[model samples]
Target: MAIDILSHRDPKVATDILKIQQESYAVEAELINFSDIPPFRDSVQSIVENDETFIGYMIEEKIVGVLAYKEEQEEIDIYRMMVDPAYFRRGIGESLLKHLFATMPNKPVVVQTGKGNEPAVNLYLKYGFEPVDEVEVEPDVWIVMMKKAQ
Candidate 1:
């Protein structure tokens, strides 16, 4: 397995990331009981046009996980962290996250996930991300924002 920066502007790369994103977010949707999560509405064109930097986890040269983030003046805002459902329990998400921290050290990092998604919440907490806020994105659907201070 390897972690590498992904060029979202490339059609093939954007398509691959979109596939993993859709599949991964589908599981999160089911877990959170919310079908309208924004990532589900994203397209390859939208990904290609996004400002966030993308990093991919590859196994035998095929992308199976992805992490996208934006670098702010004082912190890093993580927009997406996803792994193909078929590749769950294989530590792909953890690997991608660790790669981000290792490459961009000394910066505070922030992320948001479905409040009810235990796996995601636990993973963030395990990495020292503390829940900072919770917002009701829709009726009874809460999104938890977490942060790891530098």
Candidate 2:
């Protein structure tokens, strides 16, 4: 499905992000269980700021996925990532990840997901990310951290 991942930012991208999160994440997952997640009513404006830290993926000219990261002093930390439910499992997420890796020029990348998020863990592992640690952020809720060396 001819997809394009761009490094541009606009208001609609944030709106799309909220929709994607609502669609992709299960209610009980730690990814959503945390108060960190924005409610549907909140706009994605802050998240879509055209900072060097942001990247977005478009399919057929429509925003379908996005990831946000920061190039830190020692490593690249992926703070946010999501794919449109309608477009999940179509390699869009994978392509965006590969694009991020290529764009980062072989830096160490780190990501975190909920322990119950098997799909996310599997996807990260498939792309050479290894589980490095786990932290309990809430009662019975844990964050599984992984890293991939470029």
**lDDT for each candidate structure:** 0.94, 0.71
Tell me the spans in candidate 1 whose CA falls farther than 4 Å from its real position. Answer: none
Off by over 4 Å in 2: 1-9, 26-42, 48-52
Worst 10 residues of 1 by lDDT: 96-105
TM-score of 2: 0.80
TM-score of each model, paired residue for residue = 0.98, 0.80
What is the C-alpha lDDT profile of model 1 across 68-142, one tens digit per residue? Answer: 999999999999999999999998888988998999959999999999999999999999999999999999999
Each candidate: RMSD to true structure? Answer: 0.7, 3.1
- In Å, residue 34's CA in model 2 sits off its true spot by 7.1
- State the RMSD for candidate 2: 3.1
Tens digit of lDDT per residue, candidate 2, span 23-131?
A: 6554424443654443333456655563546566776667777777788888899876777777777887787788888777668999988877777888899999999
Model 1 pairs whose backbones collide: none
